[model samples]
Target: MTTTHDEDAHLASLGYTSDFKRDMSFWGNFSLGFTYLSPVVGVYSLFAFAVATGGPASIWAVVIAALGQLLVALVFGEVVSQYPVSGGIYPWTRRLWGRRWAWMAGWIYMIALLVTIASVSYGAGPFVAMLIGIEPSTAVTVACAVGLIVLVTFLNLGGTNLLAKLAFFGFAAELVGALAVGGWLLLTQRHHGLSAIFDTAGTEGNGSYLPAFLTAALLGVYLYYGFEACGDVAEEVKDPRRQIPRSMRMTIYIGGFASFFITLALLLAVPDFGKVVSGEDADPVTTILQNAFGPVGFRVVLAIVLISFFSCALSLQAAASRLIYSYARDRMMPGWHALSRFSPRRAVPPNALLLAAVVPAVIVLGSIVSENALTKIVSFAALGIYLGFMMVVLAALRARIKGWRPSGPFTLGTWGLPVTLVALTYQVLAAANMSWPRTPDAPWYDNWIVLLSAGIVITIGLVYMLVARPHERHDAPHGDAVASTLDPDSGRATEPARVG
Candidate 1:
């Protein structure tokens, strides 16, 4: 139960380089947990699908979405805790399967982050215009997106400690905002009762209950997107194998329940779907609050929404920068050796941070140039995430079915087998459904975006395979099992070895 446990010897046996500092504690991991299950991004996702689905049933859709992601998270928690390496899913698969599969996973994950950075920056547009008192237009939106990238980059260069601190603040603000909105609705809608939520009667106009349910459920996956933030900081976390599993599971459950309750509350409180959906600017949460509690309520909700975006901006910067640093160290990215350099003063990846900022900033600018262009970009972003998830889930399932047991601080038990399978099933269905073109008249439709993005990632991975394969170190020992235990006294680093 202690945070600092012996993992050094175990990791050393597995050939984990000790050069990278392992300084973060369990609290740091918990903060990462909160960051991974972001509320603001959750809100943004809900709105996107809500608009598409054109019904109040978006609330239930979120619940179903969260459930699908939970399946993925379950497998992620089991596998990651077993490896607890900075390689994240890629290394985990490599350990389970081989290098080619690892490369594929890594390529998909890297592209996923790239698209995510673009999407987030794009999302920052509306909030930026709102913050600066400008008319809401595509041009302003893109500018805001660019600004977000820059701000996040600056924040990330400050280091792991700074990332943890920012995550805490962001988590707090998001929780408060979400709860405030949910609470206001719950308090006022006492008479409508909880049954209104579990009932299928309110799902008006969205043909076929299952598809309607699936539409809203897809948005809940957004809440689970960033939990891998913990995996990104694997070197820093205390007893990463143990703490990571704990954090991942905790984040999914808390985030899932919170989103479900909040969505239900909103659905129950909604008085007029027409007014709320009439304009792109319409926010159901804001509308409900304003109607019930007047202008003060409206302002409160707006302020919270803005704060959520700010937190997301900060966390996204940290995750993306670390990803850049990881890729550079692996020599998959150009100027790898130089980009992997850490700040002497702050012990952070300054160059990597800067690069992360630049890409996202460009995305923001693009969003500003074209109204909701970032939104379109993010649909591709979701595609990237699902693509990566598909690989990881398959890998995990392969391991399970083949009786390939990898030891770690955590295990998903019998449940993991079925969950992993289900996760894969859900991923394919969700991705296919979500990627369909809104208009059949549009050439190429939505399928091309997913195809092109996947093609680009695979091509880059193939190039890496040909050019950047690291020579195997014959002396490096590979352990079949990973052992990790926290240092109880110091709570700073894990004990060298206990399990492997």
Candidate 2:
């Protein structure tokens, strides 16, 4: 087993010291990723929209997404196994390509994570209100959302140990809750046969089912991503080069299975499939659970759902703060010194955590501007995340073409380039599908929100890179670890250089 001394020596070779506590075990890392990819939150939040837009057939999107994301996860495993850096996509891109590309990748990913924090907290609002027996009005929901953000921020500030404990608890509660609810619904409340999954229920817009299915596929796209959070906190985990990869794959497998199970159960148990497809039943999840579980039981489920949401937000905040700290540590952003400051007592970056909280709370307040703001936020968050992911995939492809072979313990070997290419291709198509203007009847900006938001953020990052050139700073290493020095003929690194 790799000891803490080995981990620290590895970091030294990578041109850094282990500033974090490094107390998180493999299970804690897995819990963090699992909570971030909370199936309860994903299915509960998107079920109504997906079912209404594409009928029950939309559940297939989960399977498709899981397979595609598994490819991406494989590629990430190879990267993180070698680099094992704290910022995940940012550092991986930096090592694979260069600093300029990494700056943009981190910039895009940071914004996406902040938006997702808002999205998850906003989603938790209704469940919070439902648990308290109050109407989920816009005002009440936004207030609750902001409150949850603040609460989760405090939880995150409590240090990695507490975060890991809560994350593990949240994972257990969410999984058990999902299984119990799904099984109960299947056994006692199912209204449709398995055939219902194939029925379109008239969601075929203009005699073509393709567009509707693509639109509904956002459900799966949104759920599969949080697995990267495991890599985002790499510096805090023990033996990360090996353990983080395993934890990431485990997160996708377990989280993907849980997502599919809950979605299928909900689809089969819908009291009126036609009503949901017609949008007449806007809250089918709540309706089904309330009818099946009764008021008390439904409230209990709501409490469980709220816990899932909280854990999701906690994990997101943790990931975001780590990325910020990583960027700051590399002097890739403004106020680097302050943001990079780590609390010796708490073993966390306080300033970065606070920034994560503030940005999301401000976004939550945007709910007052438009009732549909949260939907737009959610859409753009998914698109931005995929775009960031593709950046790393593209970088890996570039590196492979330039004679870079993964020196990690978890490499794909001869299959490396193939998996990277497929992952990149899938991400591109998925991102385009997400950003495509599908809502012809809505405002132009509404239809174009995903693409437009991405364009603006990328444009800003490009302009900043050109003018500021933050990537040129020498505050930290900007390429692969010295230990990963490559050899030409074998396409593998020579013996790693030991750092004294």
TM-score of each: 0.84, 0.96
Count of clashes in candidate 1: 26
| Candidate 1: Cα lDDT at 477 | 26
**Candidate 2 lDDT, tens digit per residue, 142-200?**
99999999899998889989988999999999999999999999999988999999988
Those runs of model 2 whose alpha carbons end farther than 4 Å from true positions after fitting are: 372-378, 481-485, 488-500
Candidate 1 lDDT over residue span 75-168, tens digit each: 8887777667664665666666555666666667766676677676566566556545568776666666666666777777676777777777
- Could you tally the backbone clashes for each prediction? 26, 0
How much lDDT does each candidate structure score? 0.64, 0.88
Stretch of 10 with least lDDT, candidate 1:
473-482
Segments of candidate 1 deviating more than 4 angstroms: 1-5, 51-54, 189-195, 198-207, 274-283, 292-297, 368-376, 446-448, 463-500
